[model samples]
Target: MITLSLIGIGSGNPDHVTRQAEAAMNTAEVILIPRKGAAKDDLAELRRAICARVLRAPGPVVREFDLPVRDASGGYRAGVEAWHDAIAEVWAAELADALPEGGHAAFLVWGDPALYDSTLRIAERLRGRMPIEVRVIPGITAIAALTAGHAIPLNAVGGPVAITTGRRLREDGWPAGHDSVVVMLDAGQAFEAVDPEGVFIWWSAYAGMDDEIRIAGPLAEVAGQIAAARAEARARHGWIMDIYLLRRAC
Candidate 1:
């Protein structure tokens, strides 16, 4: 049996990686890093840097594998499990090649595994097919990064906050009765569909990263600006990860 450790590396900053996370990485027999093509090669590079910075010379066997991204516009929803299953297969094949003797394998995860991320779910799928033990080393979350970067509280005093995806906000509309909402994994334009009245937005792209960008203002005024900036950044970097907090006028 292989011991699979899911180590959260935090949002996008090397400093965000905790000591515990580093310790976990040092102990693993094999560490898997996913290369997301050329556009997002920097992400993989960051993982490499983190490993190089934390691990001693002749560290755990580091291996890179191509990561399969979800098709955002897959026709009529082919289902998430379909995509996750494919990822699990890739992971298994890579691990079988790297750790034929069933040793410890570490998966470096971005952001917290329990929040909005899918590494845990994919691991669950792998467990169904293999005899592997799973361990999670929690790290900082993007939501926390967004809030801290903006230097603002996540919720107003005694008020409720709803955390959701851009798709939900666009398809379901702003959740009623929630004065504050945190959105992650947005398609970068969902705020356009929102009712701008009384809404304030704090938007950040690549939050907590070296190339981080931030914009904030009344939603009515900055909605277009955010969209344009997001598009330009994605074009410039070939990829972007962003999060935003929306609060109704109190």
Candidate 2:
């Protein structure tokens, strides 16, 4: 049986790794790291760095695989499905090559595996192909890092909190029955779509990393500033991972 551990390393910070995650890393027979090309080389580098710090005795062998890019030629959902299938094939190949005997394997996940991540879904595709058991090690999420970076609570006392994607926020306006929203996987500034009146925003790019940037104020006042900073950061680093929290006055 193949024991696959999906360990969350938390927003690209070494200190964010928990002791339990470190133990899992050290115990695995093989660890698979994905290389998402030059544009996001920092991502793979961060995973490697985490392994270096956590794996002390070097019992587990580390391997790198080229991640398949989504086919933009097709519609977004269809393209993502195809890309995930390709990734599953790669994972199967790596498992066979690395763990011919079928022992424990681990993948280092950024942030947490359960939050806006498809690793679990991809792993489910591998279930019937082999006898596999999945384990998850939770780590700090981008929302946690963003809120902590801004030194603010996620919700007001007795208020509601909503977590959603940038696409959802843009396509659908503010969700019903919620005053605060946390937006993730935002390629564009979705905040501009919402009515800025009486809204406050806390935005952070590269949260918990050394090159972190934060901008927070009344949405009306700093929406442009956040956009400009996001553009500059993406240009300078060649890539960016960011999240933001928005609250409408009750």
- Each candidate: RMSD to true structure? 1.4, 0.8
Colliding residue pairs in candidate 1: none
Regions of candidate 2 where Cα sits further than 4 Å from its true position: none
What digit string (tens of lDDT, one per residue) describes model 2 on residues 54-142? 89774699999999888899788988899988999999889988888889999999999999999999999898677889999999999
Best prediction by TM-score: 2
lDDT score of residue 133 within candidate 2: 93
Q: Candidate 2: minimum summed lDDT over ten consecutive residues — where?
A: 50-59
Clashing pairs in 2: none
Local distance difference test scores for all models:
0.90, 0.93
Assess the local accuracy of residue 39 in candidate 2 as a C-alpha lDDT between 0 and 100.
92
- How high a TM-score does candidate 1 get? 0.96
lDDT agreement of model 2 with the native: 0.93
- Candidate 1 per-residue lDDT over residues 1-250, each given as its tens digit: 9899999998879999999999999999899999989999989999999998889867899999997777757653575777888899999998888888899999999999999988998999887777899999999999888889999999999999999999889999999999999998897478888889999999999988989899999999998899899989999999999999999988
